[model samples]
Target: MSSDTKGALLDVVKGGVVSVTLFAAFLNLPVIGLPAAALTPFPALYFGLKRGNRAGIGLVLLAAVLVALAGGPEASVLYLGQSALLALALGWGVARGYSASRSIATAVLVTLGLAAAAAAVYSVASGVDLHERVVAGIRESISQALSLYEKRGIKGDELKPFRDALEQGGEVLSRLYPALLLIGQSIVAGINVMLLRRFANRLPAPIRIAPFNSFRNPDYLVWVAIAVGFSLLIDNNVVNAAALNVATVAGFLYFLQGLAIVRHYFETYSVPALLRYLFYAMLVMQAYLAIAVALLGLFDLWADFRRPRKPKNL
Candidate 1:
């Protein structure tokens, strides 16, 4: 083989090793495991963007094989669905010079499609409904949590209310799992994209990435959000569930818009880094603040908070 071919192959192997190592950390580590898993796609995405599609695909395939050998077929499937495929989608978009939002949307749609197809195949092969299975698993987890709480004392009436609340929450979560999955994968894609942008300069060819503060969803989305809001008034459980899912997704999009607005102001004012970090920390710890931010984003449609106001006549 030529030296160039040898170098490409070696790089692929190195990237694959990094991917698997991150996946392993995600599986084995406790608190930091999730963050590690979130980054499992980075190596493939980076290599693909830097070296080309084949290198990225090689990294992903090699990593999948390593995962399957170490963790079994199911784990390999999980890695592909959760990490590899997303990397491929994001890498494809970024390499083609797609906008950040467009790239993330493409990644989300592709991953969601793959997830639905995988669920259908699993249901068919196993002769079980995937939705029902997910609900059952959720309930099982709730039961385990309740048992743990009970073992820690607080019995009788306290326990009864807690159990009831847990059951209700689990049911809601089961219903919202699909929406949650979308939001989650979107987050994963966004993070990897941001990371790629941040480090893109290190690559041979640096790509242009628009400032995050400038992000804005299409205006038509507001109408859809309004429609979902109206649909929530319907009494039917099925309708309510579906509407809730759509609203949840819409809310998340608005929340991101709101964050972009916040970032814009922060940059305009040259906000201190420590204050910005604290504000972000508060957003994570205070749910109401997040909702408020989403509202801010929504109202920005009319308010145009990001737009510069013309100087008032003296």
Candidate 2:
């Protein structure tokens, strides 16, 4: 066989192994498996970045076939529907040399749009309210968790109040689930973009992205937030919930912006890496501090917190 043919065959085999391992790890590991599972897209991304979209799609298809062979048609469809789609989106974006923010934004919007469509289809086919169904699922998962905890020796007074609080928390979460879903997808997209960018850097020509400190959303987003904020005053429950979810998503974006601002300042002042990490630890440990940072990000539109300072006269 020619060298080219051998190389192609090797690539196909490598893609298959990566896809199978990633999917199996995620399937078997459950709660702690997501990080490993996230790497499922790496093979596709590698081909896309190094070769092209054609190679990436080939990898995705191969992954679907492997998944189907191992787990059946249903599992294969699920993989194609979720993981494969995301991999293709990310890989295509990287292959095309899109900026990190734009790539992540595109992938996230695609994910949200696809999820919404699936929810609509499921609701129509099942003749059940999608929101309620989701809430029910969450409650069921919580019950399973509680059962596991009891099996592991958590019981009586210790477990009772914890269970009660968990039940209530689940309800609240379900209500805010739309926002949570968007946030979750955004995080996933961000991680994928970061990973892809890191990999791209090792290539002969790396993709360029705006510095983290300079990250900012378009001005129109603030107006959308304002509109959602106004909608919150309406008397309808449905409207209120919709507005709340939209606001929650906006707030999370602002939180990210705030973090960028924090990073910018740390870099500007030449803050020690250790101190910067400590500050981040505090943000994680203190809810109020985190909120304050997020608010700063939201207000940055008017505040221009990162504007350069003027030099003193001699």
Candidate 3:
């Protein structure tokens, strides 16, 4: 066989094996499993970007088949939604030379659409309300945690307040899960794109991605934020829920823009890498700090924090 054909076949095998390994780690390894899950798309993304579309699709299918054999059809579906689709969509975007933001957005939207469609199909087939199922799952998880806490000797009155708080939190989670899922998928797409940028030069053709420090969302998204804010004032539950979800997603985007501005200043001032890492850790650990960063990004529209003000003509 031709060397090129042999190389392609080898890549398919390698990529498929790596993808399955990552998925398995995600399932069996508790501490690092989440990170492993996040990286599950990388192999397909890398191979697809390096070899082409068919190689990427082949790798994903192989991984899915392996997962199905070991787990079930449900697990394969999960793999497709969580990793394969994102890998395929991102590969399509990058091959067409889309910008990093555009590529990530496309991948996220495509995955979300497909996932929603799948959910709808399942709901129809089983005559089950997915929303109630999600809410029940959240409550069940909380109940298990509370049970563990009770076993640790927290009883009656003490546990009552804790249970109340957890139940309330579960309700909020159920209402906002759509937004949370969108933000999560977006993060996954962004992470893969950032990783891809590191290896872009190794690909068969040159691809350009602008530096993250210079990233900015479109100016018009601010208007959407304003509309959503107004929507929250409405008394209707549906409107309020929809508004909150939009706000959550928009807030995440602004948070990213905020991080870009922070990075810009960090580079300009040559901040020490250690300090940068600490600050990022703080952002993750402290909820208020993340909100503050998102606010900083929102205000950047007027402040132009990264750019110097043009001198006024006398």
Candidate 4:
């Protein structure tokens, strides 16, 4: 058999192990055994990487059925449908060889895709009541926190912060039910990649790019600059702090991506090549910095000097 086939099979076994382990931890493996309830599209994630669309779609259907059974037909259907779509989209990207590794652009795309799809589906589906489902999850988490706080046999102002923090988190989650899926998918994908590599030797490497390549995208630089400049210009101390945090993270992630690329080269090739690659990548990333800033500076000219408007509704 081809190594790829072996890798694919390993993917299935690895995914099953991961899912079953989760089920066992939560539902008691020795007693109820692994819930066939979760055996659907989420697992298709593994299948998709190894196989193709047909296998992926089939897995989705299976997982959807299981999810429906566990979550109640309606909730399960809604969630599985989302999961199926997410898997398909992710699978397609994988098939097309999009980077599955973490990077800001990838992070943004994944977040937007999941959020946009869920928002659209929820908007269309009657009685799905996303807000309510969200509230329920938050309530459960808050309940857990409250349980912990109460167990201390202590009552004081300290408990207030814990409740307040949880409530704030719940508020954020209420609007971002999709975030739960995205976060879980990212986590699962990372774990799956690691396991496949460690055990099955089926791991695929992310396509190497110059770390600074992200900086070359003019749009990216513009938005990042806006983000940073706005942070520096903001009046409120809290907002300023938040802006600084954003700036710091973006700078760090972009730089870190370059470092990662350089390190990869060093490990796979020679030290000289690694240094050269790092230098080039750094140059590539910074290539647009000057131009982006120049364009931003020319904003007034762009606004005040609009092109002649052609007659409309002629």
Best by lDDT: 3
lDDT (tens digit, per residue) of candidate 4 on 12-64: 55554444344334344554442222332346655665566665665555544
Better of 1 and 2 by lDDT: 1
lDDT of 1 by residue, 186-232 (tens): 99888998899889887877676788898898989999998998999
Q: What is the lDDT of residue 193 in candidate 3?
A: 86
TM-score for each of the candidates: 0.95, 0.88, 0.96, 0.48
Which candidate, 1 or 4, has the higher lDDT?
1
Model 3 misplaced regions, further than 4 Å: 308-314
The positional error of residue 21 in candidate 3, measured at the CA in angstroms, is 0.4
Model 2's alpha-carbon lDDT is 0.79
> In model 1, which range of ten residues has the least summed lDDT?
202-211
In model 4, which runs have C-alpha deviations exceeding 4 angstroms? Answer: 1-42, 78-83, 102-117, 120-144, 157-185, 194-314
RMSD of each candidate relative to the true structure: 1.6, 2.5, 2.0, 13.3
Residue lDDT tens for model 2, 38-104: 7776777666556556767777888888888898888887777666777777666655778777777
Candidate 1 regions exceeding 4 Å error are none
RMSD of 4: 13.3
Estimate, for each residue in 132-158, the C-alpha lDDT of model 3 and write its tens digit: 999999989999989999999998999
